[model samples]
Target: MERQADWRQEKAQALARARVVVIKVGSAVLTDAQGLSTPVLESLARQMAALRTAPDGHERRLVLVSSGAVAAGRAVLRAHGHSGETSGLSARQAAAAVGQGQLMRAWDEVFRAYDFPTSQVLLTRDDLRARQRFLNARNTFAELMDWGVLPIVNENDTVSVSELKFGDNDCLASLLVNLIGADLYINLTSAPGVYAANPQEVPDAGILECVEDVAGLDLGRMCGGKTSVGTGGMYSKLQAARRAAQLGVPTLILPGREADVLARAFGGEAVGTWVRPEEHAIPRRKFWLAYQSDPAGTVLVD
Candidate 1:
């Protein structure tokens, strides 16, 4: 018990000192049967605003990588009398095209209530895979952060075909962590944290509070597949966390709908599972060359 307490304190201190944080909210957390949850969004916006200007007067840079365009798109489609399952790729893409604006508009209005300005950024895999484009995107993010504008990012679903998609926003958020040199990555999802078994299937599944070595654990069996509304699942989250760990960035997987969840997590409340990173940072060039680039072929050594 004492050891757990110590770990929580350590993580809280690290989070408090982090200068830049990347927050990724999943579709399951952002949307419901009716579509976007205004209450949840408003609560999140209020907390983010408070975090920006804390009572202690310390300011932290924030980047939000959010998912829910397709869900929002579904709402738009329904409103327009296009009623059918949005499971097909084309239908999903169409939903994204129509809902992207709605998603950004909702976010903008909520943030605007707090007098905060938000910029919408849409990206595809090719955008980051290419060296020149990657640098350009990085510069844009840097400028936005410098200007104190919260940049809200989403996958360019409208133009992204199967070949171009990043698979899920979890992967995109992980890449953004390295792209922007984020100090911390927060993945807010439906569940409180990673569980020993599928919580939905098992009524009494227990949560894993702290994970020091992701490689040593079997995350595949722990995290099941996708949900009804979201593309990625717990498996993708663990994969993203592992990638961020390689970049020397710790990740926190927590419940998004919890009241004051973000603030509480940073305040050292131990509300989620913490994935610790390596002590040394991986060289930026090496990371890009290994993961981002599409190598022609591989050569084996004797």
Candidate 2:
């Protein structure tokens, strides 16, 4: 395929082989400044439920890596009169405690509507970075898949120290794509995708159609919309999608607010910027090192 090829031409071919897909939902998409958008979450869940009932649905499995507990939790805390003067760590942990229940309730309501069982799996960075923990996490998801249950994962923010946190689900999304060996990774965000200039800064910023390499891209100039409940911006998402693509897992960076975008992606339509997977899945050790290898410290290449 040409570097700039309209992926639509290959949608059928792509979807045919896409058996496992990972979706990353950022707080911007799942919550308003105050808290969770029950209706939007319901709508998204309905879409996913609809997909599961599709003819080929049984052949495919979908995993959701969601971020919103902190955002939602903060709202709950504020509603309960928690002081805004709390430390960042205190606020996040408090919010997570309050909102995790609400988040699960919303997802449960939707998934149950279709008679699908959704199980929650809270993980810390250690779960992905530690080899033994990694295998255990994978096996649990594998078992869930075997039993026809959709595994819903989120970072264990309530107890995780800062360094232990994946920081944002964008990075978690990328790492999860590798963890699950997903065929496609869909990263749903508030904005559409990567742009040459920050969309807010540049009125005419255009979404790049496909990303072949982000290592050479300028990310310093990119900033997130500063959603009240979340800390990730498109820059983190670009980092996520690029990492997933490098693992030979195709990723789509699409606007979460757009109706039916996730469904369209699964249907093999060009929904947003596409980060095509590397020509092939890199070998295990190299992929593990590059995808999951711990960096002792920052090192810039000459």
Q: How does each model score on TM-score?
A: 0.93, 0.88
Among residues 3 or more apart in sequence or in different chains, the pairs in candidate 1 whose N, CA or C atoms overlap within 3 Å are none
Local distance difference test, each candidate: 0.88, 0.77
Clash pairs, candidate 2, are none
Q: After superposition, how far is residue 143 of candidate 1 from its true place, in Å?
A: 0.4
Q: Write one digit per residue (lDDT tens) for candidate 2, span 1-302.
A: 33435555544455567778888888889988668888788778887766554455456788998888877777787788885753468766877888898888888888888888999999888787777788788888888987888888888888999778887788877787777778788888887776768877888988777776665677778554655456778778877767876777777788888888777776766667777666656765576676565877788999
lDDT of 1 by residue, 1-302 (tens): 13344556668766877878899999999998878999999999998888785445678889999999999889878878989987888888888988889899999999999988999999999998899999999999999999999999999998898777899999999999989989899999998898978776787999889887775678766777887789999999999999888887889999999999988886767688998876676887778877787888889999
Give lDDT for model 1. 0.88
